[model samples]
Target: MTSRDAKTYEEAVEIVLRTLVKAERIKPTQYARRLVMKEMNPSREARSVSAGLLYSVLQKRGLLDEVIEDVLEITDDVTELDTWVRNAARIAVNEVVFEDGDPDEVADVLHGLVRRLANPGAAAIVKAFTLDLKDYEPPEPEDELDRLKWEYYHPRWLIERWMEMFGDPDEVVALLEANNRRPPLTIRVNTLKVDPEELAERLQRKYRVTVEPGRFLDEILKIPEGLPIGEMPEWEEGLFVIQDEAAALASAVLNPKPGEVVVDLCAAPGGKTTHMAQLMGGEGKIVAIDVDEVRMERLREIAERMGVLDCIETHLMDGREAPEKLGREFADAVLVDPPCSADGTIPKNPERRWRITPDELERLPKFQYELLKAGAEMVKPGGRLLYSTCSMFPEEDEEVVRRFLDEHPEFELLEVKVGDQGFDMPEACRLFPHRHETCGFFIALMGRTG
Candidate 1:
């Protein structure tokens, strides 16, 4: 489709739906990335908004199902609607049911867009769907899973797994809602160039945005609003790096000192790798390893940009076998941030939930446990091993750690102190969105006591 001005919110909704349709046809997870890459003069903020809206809509599938039920009353064969038509209806319903946008206006704009798109068959579908918009009310959520499905916009199976582990259904529901909102924009300042607090003061003066120090990363700046990091002067000079608050905590937990050898297994997109390098004051050896060549390239670029060149090394290899490649007891510290179901990241990528299943959930703990075992082998005696995942599921978090400790007596869990972040995990620290005001994450600090 050609680019057109979205003069009204409806037109904007149409554009978003069309994009999601295109993205779904290609690959669901890569949809937003593909769109952002394709835009010639993309406004990062606008794209972020579109992506957020699309994710929010997809996460609330139960609510969308209700919209479909209402539409079925006006017309049969809703199944015959094309991709764009279905997406348009979803967006309209999302605005009305989820975002609390005006129902009548949403319906009118949805109708207008379908007509303009000239898909007469789809327009008929849109018209039929819009007929009883005034009377449409989403059904109240029934159980804990349903509450999470509506509240956090997560799939039911995910909620079930979390509820089984957390035990408190309400807390799980609250965490899900927090994930659906746009996460705060956080950056880790380069202490090599400036102090984080000092930089925050300078940035606020220039951009008219407030900046605060992040809880864990002393160098992290929490910018409530400002230019995209790429456009900021600090970023161009490698004065700071954009990272999530939970992710920044990984390096702090590792707390690698200068002149030590640190290994990061599954380290791509290099957030923790670079953070570890920074924590070491760029004086230590950091071997950043990942299996994906494409991501390794990204790791290389980030390492270069962050100016941690002398201390950082990139390795493209299967992380499961990384210990064999590096030999046993090779590093002073090891950070294992393995691949996961990414359920905790649903707020960032709503389409991800639809891609996961119970079987997939069952398989993750084994993989994570194996990786942790492999990572443990790479740390020297008395050295630290920090295991982390951006997942709140017990199978991926505490259970895996507990099982690992049971199987391997050589390593012991280290208690983490964050001065009121939350009560410490017996074998790990868990950060939930509702409680920690960060992504739902888990970090286990372990030392090779043997």
Candidate 2:
């Protein structure tokens, strides 16, 4: 808990290693980044460094273990090392294997740093490992899942499910690697003030930043490393809202018109809700409902921040049960971005893979279908209901749509042109990492016929 400047790369690595160990135990995945952010109090440079190191080490664990084995010469039982020591070895190995650093040089650096930061036994282990650094080779996979395990840096079970869905091994590897890399920061330019092209030009001139106009969402600007958009001049003036390209596409697909009453069933953090308000031209009512009180408050705050206050109304109620509270056929349109496995968002939440299970997958579609049915009932006759999820799994995407359509004969699927996002599936449209540069997602637009 003592604060000291990390003077060497080795000391920095030790700090990251210690933080990673503690994060793994305390928060696991979703909360891990927040924990690291809290502990490191990292400058931007340090954030990039620690994140890059953690991912590289995790991705190339096999090669890392070899480096550790070679360095520590005494291979009695490294598995018995305390979590901190194990993590340090992982960090050292990652540096040697992935960074292409000299194994001997890295070993020496790690040994000295461990001696200072860790106890004598830990220092001895690092010293012994360093002395034998040249005797190891990268481990080879013994099976398909093992091969995928190293290739994707994911668990074998998750890869197995992906293989089943994708049916192509090479494509699965590509998908997994894409998920591991840092996703681009995409923001939707608030067209109410400035067009996307003009915003992009201004950003480049002011911050030495570059933004590319997205294909699907005309307002989406792909910003490459600058000041956080929240602090930018454009943001302060309500000229833009930070949103992902895939998420921006959702509002475009919904295509709400002015004077329409739209309900965002699971709106929270207000990304899609605000976008829906923009689509409605900020003229009509948008009842943004979320079950969590905190998220509902956040939705209201974001709406106020983005200057979409005229149209948005916040409500705290579960979408599945809220139709009874609001009455049936109350809105002209309903946008349901339901909770799912979030498999498509692995690039942003790598720890989600560890948290998911077969049972959860089985149960999620049923929950989603119920929400879709409930949300659909809230749509007036001839109104549109858009169901979406940031999940690529068919059960949560196509199957859910198909079942809802089967049960509710009053609604029919509407063909939506997502502007080169991906192929339109039978009951829905899906975006994949291999095809779309955005997060893997699925959307189905349905119109109430009754």
Candidate 3:
């Protein structure tokens, strides 16, 4: 986190590539953003560009890594090399293939990047692959999913699963590629603080923020490129919060009423919880719970910033404890946006592409089931429970909701409607990245019919 850590673009890439390797070693519960912050205290100006590189490189690391291994296989063994060396090779290969620059200059810069940051022994290995990386190509796999996994930079198991569900390899490929693209930065206007139209007018006419009404909701705004969102005066005044459109829809579906009791079981950094506060006109009680105390504190901060502190109560307890601690049938409405494999929003946070394994992520569905069931238990008869995940995997989405319905016959999937664009299930819907133009997400609204 010193001035020497990330003073230039190549240096920044080096630091991130090194951290990327380290991030893979850490637990899935940890985030790479924190690792970057700790490793390099990049100044605001530096971070704008470097953070983009760090994320872009990491998000594409899966494909870049495949290419790197291919190059390593040509001359040496990847496993025999130091972890940092492999990461460096991936970054250099990513630059060679994807970066729009003078190819030779890019290669020269990478050589210098490795020489500066790598150990003497590792530098030789990285230098040996400099030009050879440009010509490296992956060996073809006969298996359809294996081919898609190599081409699209996704886990093979996930590709196979999606292919089986869709019955079309081409369709699954589109979804996988969509996750690799950089999604538009979107935000929801804080209606409690400012009028959406007026806020848009001010942002557009004055601050030059080009915002359009979102596809699903008028309150949400799609902020275009070329503007720093955090620097906007509206953001400082808490007139809006950066959130994905799918998550905004989930909160919109919950639709808490004024003075009603609501619980956001997996709420952290308070996106939906605060949005619920806005929907309730800052009049309802919302208990926001998350296991991470730091994020829970940020949730409180966001609530206060959005001028909705009076409505929300933050709790630093495990989401599993919400039903027991808050008492069963306590809330009029509940939202359990539980943690999943994060398949839906990878375009925005691309590091997820390489940071998780299929086996490592298998536990997501079981925990998602537990949280949804807990949220269901917390809803009173006639009240609603909305179970959502930023993932499109059937096991983590519809199947969990389906099982919950079977086990708790008292609850039935509520008829949640969207335009014909959404894949309508009997009681749930899956918003796909390719089809919906939103992060891959699933939501099932259930009512305690008993």
lDDT (Cα) of model 1: 0.74
lDDT of 3 by residue, 95-203 (tens): 7766644445555556666667666667666667766655655576878667777667677776766777788867887888888776666889998878889887887
Tell me which of candidates 1 and 3 scores higher on TM-score. 3
Per TM-score, the best of the predicted structures is 3
Computed on alpha carbons, the lDDT of every model, listed in order, comes to 0.74, 0.74, 0.75
TM-scores of all candidate predictions against the true structure: 0.82, 0.79, 0.83
Per residue, candidate 2 scores C-alpha lDDT tens digits across 346-409 of: 6655556555678888889888988888898899998999999988887888888888888899
lDDT of candidate 1 over 125-183, digit per residue (tens): 77666655656766778875676576666667777876776788777767766766665
Clashes of 2: 7
Q: lDDT (0-100) at residue 223 of candidate 3? A: 66
Q: Can you list the residue pairs that collide in candidate 1?
A: none
Stretches of model 1 off by over 4 angstroms after superposition: 1-11, 18-52, 65-83, 99-148, 350-356, 419-427
| Weakest 10 consecutive residues of candidate 1 by summed lDDT | 1-10
How does candidate 3 fare on TM-score?
A: 0.83
lDDT of 2 at 410: 89
Off by over 4 Å in 2: 1-44, 54-93, 96-139, 226-238, 419-424
Error of 3 at 324 (Å): 2.5
How many residue pairs clash in all the candidates, one count each?
0, 7, 1
